[model samples]
Target: MKRLKEDNLKHFFAEETLKKYSVVFIIILAVMLICELFIFNFKWVNSAFDKKVDAEMTLSGINESGTDLKFTSDSATIEYKNLNEELKYLYFKPGSNKGGVADITLSAVDEANSSYFSAPSRTVLTDVKSSEYIRLRFSGEVKDFKITVNGMNGKTISKDNIGLNVRVPLMFSWIRFLLLSLTLMLLYVLRPKSFVYNYKTDLSKNWQRIVTLALVAIQIITFWNMIHWNTGVLEWHKSYEHHRQYYSLIDAIKEAHLYLDFEPSSALKNMDNPYDFRERYAQNVAFKWDHAYYDGKYYVYFGAAPAILLYLPYNLITGNDLPNYIAVFIFGIMIMIGILLLLWEIIKKWFRNTPFALYLLLSVVFGAAACLAYAVQKPDFYLVPSLGAIMFGLFGLAFWLSAERKNEDGTTSLISWRLAVGSACVAIIAGCRPQLLIVTVFGIILFWNSVFKERTLFSKKSLKQTVAVCLPFVIVGAAVMWYNYARFGSPFDFGANYNLTTNDMTKRGFVWGRTGLGIFTYLLQPFNMDAVFPFIHDFNAATVYQGLTLTEMLMGGVLWLYPILVIGLYGAFKKNSFSDRRSYRFVYFSVIFAVILAILDAQMAGLLTRYFTDFVWIAFIGTIITAFAYYEMLRDNEHSRRKFAGIILTFSVITLVLCFLSIFAHTEDSIMKANPTLYFTVQHLIAFWM
Candidate 1:
């Protein structure tokens, strides 16, 4: 019986399977070796252990009170006059700075040679609130050196928590290495093959559900991981203290009012031109921040759809205000589902012959793109409308594409319910994000053959279809307009012009010169790279236009961040490559609409990364469409098909990594600010040898 069992186990574990596993193990080992030697700069495995070295040092030009080194002036010095041997590292455990460091510098000098030694240009305690250990390394040998601090800005360093020649272990991140190995194995298995290219099998039909479930789980996990550190309890109208607009809007609606309950200060109301930021600051007047101030009333200038759809219902049922992070989580999952449904519909309708691997690649590209990450990372009231618009817009397009039905006699007819539902979803965008309502224009092109070419939209033969397509728009539009009128006294005025913000929007008309800067910054900005962990950094957007151009530090432009989207431009001109003419038109129109929205956002809102939400999705869709068509075109050439598929996967993986790390850049809204411990831990884990 034992011999028989062993034989059966051997049969199950074939030699080929063993060989594959061995290859994967060997690949992982090779990668770790390279990282330890070249990337982490570890000399030997035995050197991983730390060794303490003794040195005599003296401090000057600084006052030591308790553990703090308070600089008497703008500069201070620490001279290591004697050392047993050459020193390699100096470790520091920083003291707390709630207000954060400002223009601080620490320079190492071999004072005898009058030369500056290498060190971090700025301190590694970037997250000033934490007391984590940080180290400074020397390039060659350092028997004697003086460390100088300039531009101190009244900052203090911890005096007692310092060490010399602390030889810490040189370790590579095992978690990251294992993840890379798994990712490589997954890609190798999912790579294009003969079976994948066989369109008759329709492998996407089998894999779509599985891939979507995995993506949804990933989205939820990331959302929770970001918030788990801070979320302690739920409270009624909890976000009110944080000046959340949605919470306040729901509270007002519950009390049967159209405007927010926040009252404008009499001083600001009495002043002429309260919209002027300088006037508000100069007078020291207290007023609601970012609220619409019109005729002595404060109103929520942001869309009310999120409040009515999510916050109001939650408040009514549970008597507790829904937090923005929870709402964002729900919307993000819906967006992922909508992306899958839309991609499935498009593949089913037009690109039926698309390779299975290509479909999976597009799923990652569309579902987890940089724009969605930006919108979801800092969950707040500001992100609610953008997420809502994206979620519903994707569903609207998907339902619209799915409305066509094949009949018994080889003819097609529109499903009345599906058409009406799709229109209703599209109309909701006007309430959530007015700028994104431009997506509804695609409906006209989608039904052009039936409405204009065949004149069947209003014909007696298709009366139900006409009502299904038109009634929802009329009803939703009227409701949205009525809501607007109730708030701002006029249906046409959405109340943005009356906002008490940085500029007087009512008088800030368009400037022709701003267009050039807007386009360049939004579409053509390049990324700043460095030889450090999370190397992508933010850059100043310099423009020749002499105007008050409002721009924050930009990480990079959308096109440069995701270079794969450039294919959409080629797809626009290569109309003959597409199998479906209507699909070709959709791609062409998407490119134009993306450009128009970019110009609109740049002109109206100025340059910010969050504005990418307005148009990146549509551009990604166009690019994905082009990619599918290109893949199908290469069906006859197997080698070309495999090569193209590999290129798509490579671009997608690299782009996803860059986008996720972009959140950690030195920006105002960075992970380092929100959670300092997590940031430094990751920094140390990846660059342990540093």
Candidate 2:
């Protein structure tokens, strides 16, 4: 009773201290948020439009000058005339126009001295709108006509006097900023507050509270920074306009009219009418909003609906652009929560000590290297779902590995729920990225095998149960397959049409997985790849070298220590003395199998480092479990145990440092140019290689 009272008192004081600091942190964060609003000028609508214009201009440039541009037989030859002023417009016979204006320079060649015209000049034009055909009455004789035809047969026309204007939309600029501010204000008000202080009396409760607060903070911050809150402001208004433009499609649908019914004569048989054909044929066009609309085929493309769901009424009220960043942010928070849950489960099943739990948590959260890797590598979004699926599989295997399940009396178990949710998460992952279906299948098979070890192909009951458990996933998988088939005419076709046209087979084949060289570069010599180490070029190393700088290697190493621990646990399984050895072994094998499957899938075309991030995480978990299993081995020998612990700790620290350094060193040149100081600080502290 006395001890309990003392512990309670200690906890109370700690809570008080935490409360005091948390208050300060909240105030500071609030002030910072306000200051950020002012410091970073938000231009919602104009910026969005500006980006669109820039994209259009860039695309126009590429179409005009890129080597890939192909001219058809029907292309017309246009004439260029020298203008005395800084700006000049060239008139063309209007038709359903597809091309934009491009600047062309002309120079006269002299045969006498073989010299070109001096002062080779330049002219710039904007708003080069094109239309079908224009009938013009000419009164004067045109002179010095130089025709530079871009398409098949060259044809040219000359004109002298033309009009030009520099028109800019000033209203959009201010309206966008205003809308952005309103959205930010809404987000700020609804942001999570001092929930931690409410549950400070109990340590366990306090931990949960802290984690929740942390997740909320991460979500808000990520949404604000990563998604760019200002971008949403522009989207909100644009969405309405998009809906207005697509009203015709809706009307046609309501009238039970097919695209062919409305425009039988307008069927696009040539590339010239592709844009018009696409606009007419595509259905479910609620709003032709930028990337936000569910791409007519039911495949979630824009990720706007989910983002809007995050804030609900507040977002609707403020008319904020639905930023997909919210989804990414939430995904990241879920990952952190999932990790914490896994860690808690590990501690509960192994140490069962509060101090040990605290230590592990602190080490994970505050370890310099680990923190750096986590900050830079934005792996949480996808990693969490993958890890969650693995965790479910592991827990299911644990049920099968139970020493004497008959001895225990329980009709219902959490394992069933874990299996269902885990399988669903895996299905979701597969749906999001079809390639991951291979990993999901591997996990399901591993789980089944773990349950029915030597019983082979004849175990009907086990097979039935497994099938029943996986039915939901099968349905989801089939749905996804059907979706792919609908989109590309073949279930397995991954939209290779773009690749076919580009004719960049290197990118289409195995090079850099999707394009350049091949998966060999990443697998045979991961260290040499730009992803692992920016400077290293060697590819002949026999084993994985710490190609990353010391700091980066250390950080990444610490986070990945879980895989090593799993390996150690597997080795200990041979001892046959530990009571839970078999369970640990099962987990170890399952994780290893999953990793192998992930690696194999990644070795094919279209693999990336991020695609294999989940494997790294699962490997880490296995390592931790192995460490827990072998804890008693060290305790039995004090001197040896101390040495082992020191060595492991040192190695973890070193690896963590290296990981952090590797990620930190790669600066985002694009971001830095926009906001140099902020970019530099964040890049050094948290930005990941991706």
Which candidate has the top score in lDDT?
A: 1
Q: What TM-score does prediction 1 earn? A: 0.86
Best by TM-score: 1
Tens digit of per-residue lDDT, candidate 2, span 1-690:
999999986775455365645554566556545443443322222133321110011122113433233223243223223322221122332112322232333332322213323222221212222111111112122222222323222222222112121221222223334444554443332222312212212226666567546744654464335434123222332344422222232333335531211221222222232223234345322222221111122112211112223433434466443332343444444555455455555445444322342334323532222122432334223233333343333333333222112225532122444455555655655444444344454344434434555342225544644554576578867765665565545665544222211122223232222221212322223343343322222222132322211111211121232223334435434545344544355455645544454445433322333334434544445555554444445555656644544444545544544453444333321222333333333332221211
Q: Write one digit per residue (lDDT tens) for candidate 1, span 403-481.
A: 9775798666788888998988888888788899888878887787777655556688899999998898899889889
Q: Model 2, stretches more than 4 Å misplaced?
A: 1-321, 346-355, 358-415, 438-468, 492-609, 612-614, 667-671, 679-690
TM-score of each: 0.86, 0.45
C-alpha lDDT (0 to 100) for residue 21 of candidate 1: 58
Question: For residue 549, what is the lDDT in candidate 1?
Answer: 63
> What are the per-model C-alpha RMSD values against the true structure?
5.7, 18.4
